[model samples]
Target chain A: MDSEYKKEDFLLLFGSRIDIIRRKKGYSYERIAQGCNIDGSDISKISKGRVNITLSSILELSKGLDIHPKELFDFEIEA
Target chain B: MDSEYKKEDFLLLFGSRIDIIRRKKGYSYERIAQGCNIDGSDISKISKGRVNITLSSILELSKGLDIHPKELFDFEIEA
Candidate 1:
């Protein structure tokens, strides 16, 4: 449950999840950037949990990955 | 793919998804507010697609709903 985690924790986890997914698809930050409005540097920062990105950014990331937006939230929240 | 939609569209969809989930759980705005930092009125605005909420807010909403954050994003994007 999300109750067990702080907001930053979830952001960090979501970032890593994005990292994993992008890597799995063999996408470079530039590659992802080419597909969306986000810059490659921003994507790097996001993957490191440095960005408190909004829902629109999430949608852009999903577009960059060519995946469903829900997939970005697919990582597990450990207890 | 998220490429089919704009940022506002995703926000609206995400908002509606939250509305659906809260209704399914029989959680009113006040009920959810009691579980998180968000005010009931803000939740209403968020549900109406009027807020471009950050990652932290999403976490709080998930906590309020006692659900995984991914569940908040489980709706389909129609073409």
Candidate 2:
């Protein structure tokens, strides 16, 4: 497929978006991780774009943050 | 977290949505997999809710189907 969206590009953008959301809510990675029943390191990895996160993890993060799942997915794309 | 959204429920809904999109686009798993350079078995697994697919994969599917990424993420929630 003639696609312009690279995997790493999307991952980085997604990570940055999550980080922004986390900061906006004043929630640390550890706190969010504990609330979501996920490891802090995994959350860190996701924020660092070092690992691929599952859909369950994404929704769990939203649940932990007391936000809607769609909010987690809301991001502006420049690419 | 008071999430009425269960992990299994979302996965099933997601898989079903993807399946519906595939059918609506008139594209088979094999054809889509071939177009996106993904394995047909993996596509089947995603559609069957037997595996967790990455965000990149979901985007690649949209690319393969000649649609937007947001469209892949779109679904009418009945829960």
Candidate 3:
């Protein structure tokens, strides 16, 4: 599209948001992994924007963090 | 996890939300398709919760809808 942001940028921002939330909650990747199928190492990769996480992953992450999935996407994106 | 809702439910809810937004905007799937890689048919599948869309697809859908990606996930998910 004509937008300035690319898919990669969006993924990076999403990952950063996850990192921020987990850190704020004092939850390690292992802690988050306890509630989901993803490995703690995979969570780390996802937090680093290394994974193209799916909708299922989103649910897993939210369940892991015990928060609404929408919270993960609660970050700014210029219109 | 022990939550009542499953990943499938989340996908269904998310798809419903997209349908709500697109309809509210008076946008057809074809119209949304014009701005992203997803086809109108795929959008139809997604709206029906038949597709487990990826993060990139989320970005494409947001671009297609001309809204923040977060808006796509703006739905209530019970704890």
Name the candidate that leads on TM-score. 1
Worst 10 residues of 3 chain A by lDDT: A1-10
Give a tens-digit lDDT track for model 3, residues B1-79: 3455788888898899999999999999999999888999999999989899999999899888998777888888765
lDDT of 2 by residue, B1-79 (tens): 4556777877777788779888998989888886685788888888877777777776677667766555655764443
Top candidate when judged by lDDT against the true structure? 1
Q: Residues B1-79, candidate 1, lDDT per residue (tens digit)?
A: 7466877878889999999999999999999998899999999999999999999999899888888888989988874
Which residue runs of candidate 1 sit more than 4 Å off their true CA positions?
A: A2-4, B2-4
Tens digits of lDDT, candidate 2, A1-79: 3477787877787788789899999988898876676777788888877766777887687776777556665665554
CAPRI tier of model 3: medium
Q: Write the per-residue lDDT of candidate 1 for residues A1-79, one digit (tens) a residue.
A: 6465887888898899999999999999999999999999999999999899998898889889998878888988875
TM-score of 1: 0.95
DockQ of every candidate structure? 0.78, 0.44, 0.63
Q: How do the predictions measure up, each by TM-score?
A: 0.95, 0.79, 0.94
Which segments of model 2 are wrong by more than 4 Å? A1-4, A76-79, B1-4, B76-79
Error of 2 at B63 (Å): 2.3
Which of candidates 1 and 2 is the stronger one according to TM-score? 1
Clashing pairs in 1: none
Model 3 ranges with Cα > 4 A deviation: A1-4, B1-4
